[model samples]
Target: MSNLRVAIIGCGSIAQNRHLLEYEENKYVDIVAVCDIVEERAMVTAEAFGAKSYTDYEELFSKEEVDAVSVCLPNYLHAPVSIAALEAGAHVLCEKPMATSREEADQMIETAERNGKKLMIAHNQRFVASHEKARKLIAAGELGKIYSFRTTFGHGGPEGWSADGENSWFFKKDQAFIGAMGDLGVHKADLLRHVLGEEFVDVAGFIENNAKSEITVDDNAVCILRSESGIVGTLTASWAYNAGEDNSTVIYGEKGMLRLEDDPSYSLIAQYTSGETVKYELGQIQSNDEGGQTNTGVIDHFVEAIVEDKKPLIDGEEGKRSLEVILAALESGETRKITQLAK
Candidate 1:
């Protein structure tokens, strides 16, 4: 098989830290083009990878033939850019939150289907080592009859991680759609669904901008989610963790309890009802902090899926399903009512 020629849209932190590096490391991938509104950023990335640089994605598409693209643009641009890439005959691996609204997400999926292209969402949490191990354990009935969980993803804020620091579009409602929820919450939503192998059926929560005065978008959000099998849990996404990042999940079950990404030493710890304790050092979860550039397994999976002509684990439909939980939580926060997800 020939190498998969790839383009990266939006040379932001995600593109720089994850997609670009991962693609470069993949033997099956060729980084053929890079695009960013900021010409300097595009040029820098393109030079580093020995690829073409473009200020406009449309122009890049017109000139460069790409087998796949990573849509690392802002939240609002996810759907449109992904649809455009798919229509241009390239598989798309878009960043999380998928889109600002369900309608946009649906359109992205429809466009991918129409063009016969793969549309994968970069919900990297699902690819975390601890998360993968937990999913398997639960699937094997190790955590029998799961009852509850509390998953959280929090950090100081996007200013430190975004390309433009404090001036990044993440602080704007129009560009980001939602702040912590969209940036961080959607990750946990997708992770929970994958680990539990269930859909979230209901959501209720509060989303507020209490932590950041300069931002119009919410900086903190806490959601109560109920899965289809009656399992319930809380999901918290925050940008107010000034001390350190907290990306952890604790699951309670009839047979044992599982703690994931909670300990610095052990990535996963399992405690059984009969006095058995097990710990697995499955490496660390990737984070915004320095020395957190662990291989995410997302780019490799996307490349493999395209090369093998198979559906990605987190395809467009899966991405939309996770987005629905975030959207429902947003509605619940605004309306002060429990939002029931569509069946």
Candidate 2:
């Protein structure tokens, strides 16, 4: 098949690191156009990848013969941009947190359904080799009768990555909609759901601004989740962990436990009830690491799904699940009670 002509909206860090970089490596993809509110960022990214640049996504969508688009905008813009791209007949790979709210996520999914185009979320943890192995083991019941799990995603605040760091729209309620939960927590939430093959049905949470003195949005969040299949777990996301810990998840069950650590290497540690402990080092969790580039794994998967006419590993509905859990957590935190995922 010929290269899938692709346009990228929001030529931000994620677009630069994941989508653009991944497309550069995929012989089956050609970066066609790039759009960002800042035209210079778009132009620079486009020039780097031999593509066109646009300040307006609508203009890009109209003039480019694009087969797909990756939406890497802030959380609030995810659904609107994705819906527009899908309606324009482009398969969309949207960065997570899928949207600011569940209702918006539903609309994006519906648009993809109506257009019959692929809509995937850039939930790269699902593609991490260690996470994948753990998922397979869990599915195979190697972690027999899964009982509980704990997951965390924390880092020093987004000062260097985002344009304005602490002063950026990321900390603004109008622009970002939420903070740590939307930025990093969603990844862990999605990872948990994917690994266990379960949907969180209820959540109770505590969200706070314990650090980063200037931001109104949360910097720390802790949540308890109960899945539809009766699994229970805890998730903690923070931007205040000094020296910071990369994302990690520990799953425990009747027969054994699986530990996924994303740093130093994508290592999987298994401790069986039979007193046998095994370590499997998956090396790296991502596709490439050109200047802090994230796993191109998700982007490559999106390209393959479009080219091969196969469903992406994390489709529209699947993407929405994590956002649903986050929304539940947010509501639970506000109401000071457990909340259920919207039906």
Best by TM-score: 1
lDDT by residue for model 2 (69-124), tens? 98989777888889989989999999889888778988998999899999999888
lDDT of 1 by residue, 173-242 (tens): 8899899999999999999999999998999989999999999999999999999899999999999999
In order, the Cα lDDT scores of the candidates are: 0.94, 0.85
Worst 10-residue lDDT window, candidate 1: 286-295
> TM per model?
0.99, 0.95
Compute the lDDT of residue 74 as modeled in candidate 1.
89
Q: Highest lDDT: which candidate? A: 1
- TM-score of candidate 2 to 2 decimals: 0.95
Give the C-alpha miss distance for residue 293 in model 2, angstroms: 3.5
